[model samples]
Target: MTADPIDQALFPPFDDAAGFDRIRADLGAFLPAIRAVCERHGLAASGLAAFERGTNVVVSNDAGQIIKLFPPFLRHQFEAERLALGRVHGNVPVATPEILREGELDGWPYLVMSRLPGRTLEEVWPALGGAERAEALARIGEIMTAAHALPTGGLESLDLGWDAFVERQIAGCEGRHRRMRLPERLIAQIPAYLASARPLLPTSVIPVLLTGEYTPENLLVTQTGGAWRVTGMIDFADACLGPAEYDLLGPCLFLAAGSAELQRAFLVACGTGIADADLTPALSRKLMALALLHRYSNLGYQVRIEGWESQASSLSALEQLIWPFPVR
Candidate 1:
C-alpha cells in the first residue's frame, strides 16, 4: 500500500457507522460477481470478508486467501507483482500474498491471494505513542531491510530500460489525465516535467529491490507469542524494477509517518549505506517531484476518474511528498 496523499482528507470514514454501511452496500453489489468467479475457480465455500488495507480485499476461508481488485488500467501491474512476491518468498520475514488466480470480472481484472492472519497496522498505529511508534517503525524497517538484502538477480532481469520505463509511466500518466478531465494547467505540466527531467537521467543503471508499494496501509503487523513482528507485506500489484533509491522513497513519505529520524533509521536497516550523494536536499527534491508527478499524472488520475473515495487522500499526500520543508 503506497500512501494515498489524499487518503486522510478525501476518503469516507471506514470505522464510522455510515462508512461501514456504504461498504456493505458496495459489497452487496460486488459479492455476487466475486462469488461467481470463485465458483468458476472452484472455491465456492470461501466466505468473503472486506478488509481496510488501502485497497479492496475480500477474504474467504475456503478460497485459500484474500482477493484484490484494482481498476482496469492496473491489469499490467500484475507482472511486477508476481516477480516481487517470488523474490521475497522465503528470505524476508513477511507473508507475500499468493496469487491463486487472476482475470477480469465485469471488465476489471483481479488477483486472488492467500490470506494471512493478523490485523493491519492501521488498527494499532493510533494507540501507539512516541517510543512505541518508533518501535513499530523499527520492526517495519527490519522487514523491509531483510527484503532488500535478498538477491536482486531475478528482479534485475525483468528490468525495462530506464528510458522505456519512463516513457511508459509518462504515457500512462497522460492517458489517465485525459480521462480524469483534470485542469489544463495540471495536464500541461506533464510534458514540461518530462522534457526537463528525462534529459537529466543518468546514462547508467543499478539493481533495485523493488516492492512498488511500501506504505503502512499495505503492512500487516501481528503479535507472535509476546513480541510484535511484521506478519505480512501485501499488495505488490505495482511492483517495479528501477533505481535502488526509488525503493526507499515511499517509506520516506508514509511509513516513516513524517519522522526524518525514523526514515533515516529505515535506510540504515536496509543495510544499503545511505550515500551522502543521494541524500542531498537537491536529490530528495528531485525524487519527491518525480513521485508527485508520477502520481498526479498517472495513479492519482486513475483514482479520481474511477471515483474511488478511499484513495482520494493520495492526491493530497502528493503535496506533502513534494514539499517536506515548512512553509515560509
Candidate 2:
C-alpha cells in the first residue's frame, strides 16, 4: 500500500545532499498546507501558488506577499533571512522583502514577507542588448558595493566564521565537485589549483554582508528612462559573513555569461579593477575555486560556456573559459 505521499511525510524532506524532487512532485498537497498557513496568518491566500523557485517550499499570495517555509535542516537560512531583511531595509540602495511575521508551521519554520517591485533581471536579460546588459550589470555592481560598504554591525551573528568556512569549503571542494558531476579532467586538478588559490582569499579585511547568489535572478530591474536599471535585490536566506569577492562569482559567471567586456564592467564597478594585466589570472583562479566551493555551486547550469568540458584541459583553461579574456 502506498501511504498517501504528502500525508506520509512528517515535514518537508531535509534539504540535504539528495535535493527536492519529491516536494515538487507532491506540490498539490503542499499548496493546501500553505493555504492553512495563510489562513492562520491572516495573509491573502486566494491566489496562493507555489513560487516554483529556489530550494524551499516558497509560495506566493495575491496580496504582494511571499511565504517561504524552510525545512528543519535549513533553519540556519531562516535565521539569516529575518536578520537580513531588517538590516537591508533602509541601509542598502535597494529593498529586500520586509518580514511581516515569522513562526513555526507543522514543525517547519516560515517567514511571511512583503514582496518588492520590479521584474527579476533574469526574466528580461534575453531581451536586453549588450549595452543594456552592461548598464544593468554596472548598476548591480554599485549596489553590491553599497551593501558591502555598510558596517557589519549585527551580521556577525550569522555565526559562520570566514576562516573556518573557507577551510571547510577548501577541504570539501573535491568531494563536492565530484558529486556535482564535474568532469574528471577538471576534477583531477582541484587540489593543486586550490592550494595556489588559497592565499588569494583575504582573512584580514573587514567582513561584508555576503549574499549567497548575486546573479540576475535575485536582482530586480525596471525600464527607467528607456534603459533597464537594477531596482531591488532579493533572496537573502543563504546569506552570511564572507569576503566580498565571494559574492561576485555568480554574477560574473551567470550575468557576464562569458563576455570579457561585461565581466570587466562589473568587476571594475564593484571596485575590483581588472585593468592591470597581472591581477586577472590570480583573480580568475580565486573566483574559480570559490565557484566550486560555493554553498550552492552547480556547475551544470552555472557554467554557460558550451563544449567547455572538452575544451578546458586544465583548471586555468576553465578559468579563462569563464572569464573569457586576457585583459580589458
Candidate 3:
C-alpha cells in the first residue's frame, strides 16, 4: 500500500532544532527540485530564509520573494491562497505581493510570491502613544473598508460566501477539538452557537473584503518620507470572501489595544454597518470568550498530539479571559 505524501510530511518528528534538522534533511531531497524551478523562473539569486513556524515550509529571500511549501495534504489551501490573491490583484486596498509561481515542488505544493515592502505593523504599534495609536487605528479601518469595497460580483469561483465561511469555522473547531481531546462539552456547544447565531452572524457580517487571518503577522506598514502608510498587506493564505464586520474583528481582537472606542471607529471606517450605539463592552466580551474557546481548542490539540508547544501556548493565550473553570 502506498503512503499518502502529505501524511508523510504531517507525521514528520518536528520538535525543536534536532527534529527540525531531520525535517530539513527530508526537505533537502526536494530542495534541488525547488532550486531548479526557481532557477527556471530566474529567481536563482534571491536571498533565502526559512521560517519553520507553521505547517508549511515558509521560505523567503532578500528580494522579498516568498515561497510557501504547503504540505501535500493541504493542496486545497495552496489553491485557495492563489485564488484569493488573484481576486485582490490591482483591487486590493493596499499594495499586495504578486504571485510569481504556483505549482508542486516534487510532491509538495508550493507558492512563490514577490515580497511586499515594509515592516510589520506589530513592531510599529508599540512606538506610538495614545493619539498616534488612535490615528493609526483609523487608517487601519480605512484599509479594511477599501478591501471590502472590491467588486465580488461576477466572480463566483472566488467568492467566499457567509455560509461557506461559517461551515469552515465550525469544521475547523471540530477538527482541532477532536485532535486535542478538548472537552466534549465545548465541542457540543459549537453546534448550538452555530444554530442560534446563524442569523446574527450574517447580520454582523457585511460582505466586503475578507482576509480570513487579520492577525498582525500578516500586516506590513511602511514609512514613506515621514508618513507611515499601510504599504503592503501580505499573506492571502486565509483570505476569503465574507462579511466586512467579521473582518474588522481581527483588528479588534489582535490590534487596537482591544478598546471599545477604537473598535467602534474601526467598524465605522470599514463600513461594517454596526452603529456606534451598538459598540459596547458586550462586543468585547464576545470576542474575548470566542478567543479563549479557540485558544483552548487549538492548544489542546497541539499538546495532545505533541505538536509545537510554543504555538499551542500562543493560541492558548490568545483567548485569555476570566474563566470559571480552573486551569488544570
List, residue by residue over 1-328, the lDDT tens digit for candidate 1.
2121221222223655445445633555456556655665777545666653343434454545665555444455655666777777677876777667776654455666687777767667666566666666666667766776677775654565765666667677656666767555555666765565554444366656667556666778887776555678877766665566566656655545445555555655654565323444444445544564453334332221233333224333333443333322
* Model 3 lDDT per residue over 147-254, tens place: 777776544554566665556666676666666764655555655544543444453344564776555667778777765666677776665566555565566555
Q: Is candidate 1 or candidate 2 better by lDDT?
A: 2
Clashes of each: 11, 0, 7
> Model 3: runs farther than 4 Å from truth?
1-30, 153-155, 158-161, 164-199, 203-208, 224-228, 281-328
Q: Runs in model 2 with CA error above 4 Å?
A: 1-21, 24-27, 271-279
**Reference-based TM-score, model 1:** 0.63
lDDT of 2 by residue, 54-106 (tens): 76777777899988877767788888888777777778777778888787765
User: Sorted by lDDT, highest first, which candidate order results?
Assistant: 2, 3, 1
RMSD of each: 10.1, 4.6, 8.1
* Whole-model lDDT per candidate: 0.57, 0.77, 0.57
Which pairs clash in the backbone of model 2? none
**lDDT of model 2 at residue 297?**
78
TM per candidate comes to 0.63, 0.89, 0.69
